[model samples]
Target: MFEYTIIDKSLENKIILITGAGAGIGKEAAITYAKLGATVILLGKTVSKLEAVYDEIIALGLAEPAIIPLDLKGATKQNYIDMSATIASQFGRLDGALLNASILGELTPFTQIHEQIFNDVMKVNVNAQYLLAQALIPTLQLAPNASLIFTSSGVGNQGRAYWGAYSISKFATEGMMQVIADEYENSTLRTNAINPGATNTGMRTSAYPAEDKDKLATATDIMPLYVYLMSDDSIAVNGKTIKAQ
Candidate 1:
């Protein structure tokens, strides 16, 4: 499992938001961040799952978490704008945000790809992210220092056979991160992407069923990088593609 030898309360009092916070990498990141002293706003399609994570954080005596049940596949610009406004009202400012929610549509040959699947994947993986970022920029700017982390994939940087729309969306994600990073180059906000290579998550299991799950790193393992990117420790690092393994 991935481990972080260093632990600090540097994130104390930080207001952080994590999409896809109900499961896998997103869940682990939310738990870790809360433990390290950030008040996490958990966003996921499943209210039950989000509540579960919230309860776990409360159980640990960490910062209390808020739950937002939202499905990115069907979210609109107005939805993101409303969410941003809500966060601003509740937290005053957003210290960081993790764009971790994504959909992996059917993996098939380019000629065999279905339009519905492609559009669905793009809506969740690309469009929603863009809208969320656009909506949250004002909230992020209110903070003294803020970070935005986008979840990316290896296939994004290098095209692979049969990776389908998921890969394409990740590429757009990386590009989006770079564009935002560049735009906020002299500002308090920073953006970056992380490729959590071959972790033992449901998504990895679906992508590589033949692989030995026991050999893969757990979602917790890659959290150090996640925490680092979100916290002040990595304020100087931006617009870079980092691998968490």
Candidate 2:
């Protein structure tokens, strides 16, 4: 894990948005942020899952989280723009955003990759991130210090066989993070990517069904890096991809 102390209420008064808040790492991150006194916006495709997380937060006496149901595969640039506008109007500013939602398309041979699956993967993992980041930049800038975190994988920077479109999309994600980080290097907004290594997520099970999930780290186990990246401690850290073990 990244070396950073988890401080109590380190994120007090912060407004943070997390995609894929329905489950896995995204879900854990949302709950963790709320525990640290952030007003979390749980954005996911499933309303029920969002509500469940919201209820959990409320039960824990954490800040009341907001929910936004959005399907990135079908959403357009305008949708993101409208969403960002609403966030700005409601909260006045955004302190952080963790872009964690992604789809793991079928893992197949490079030559045997399906056109539709590849397109769908790219649409959710790359294009939607591009549009969403563009829309959220202004709101993120409103804070004294802000962090934009993109979720990445082990194969993102280094390619692996049979990873197909998923690998390609993650490379694009890393590239996108770097470009945004460079553009905002002098500003208060800092962009970085986290490669959650072999966490036991649903996507992980789908990708490697026979793997020993019991040996893998749970989402909660890798949150030190997640919390550090979103905290003010990492304001000077930008344009880099850090691993969460």
The best candidate in terms of TM-score: 2
Q: Model 2, residue 20: what's the lDDT?
A: 98
Clashes of each: 1, 0
Tally clashing residue pairs in candidate 2. 0
lDDT of 1 at 205: 83
Candidate 2 per-residue lDDT over residues 105-221, each given as its tens digit: 999999999999999999999999999999999999888999999999999999999998999999999999999999989999999999999999999999999999999999998
- lDDT winner among the candidates? 2
Clashes of 1: 1
Q: Output the lDDT of residue 94, model 1.
A: 99
Q: Cα RMSDs of all predictions?
A: 1.3, 0.6
Worst 10 residues of 2 by lDDT: 1-10
Segments of candidate 2 deviating more than 4 angstroms: none
Give me the runs in candidate 1 sitting further than 4 Å from their true place.
Answer: 1-5
User: Which ten residues in a row are the worst by lDDT in model 1?
Assistant: 1-10
**Candidate 2 structure, TM-score to reference:** 0.99
What does the lDDT read for residue 174 in candidate 1? 94
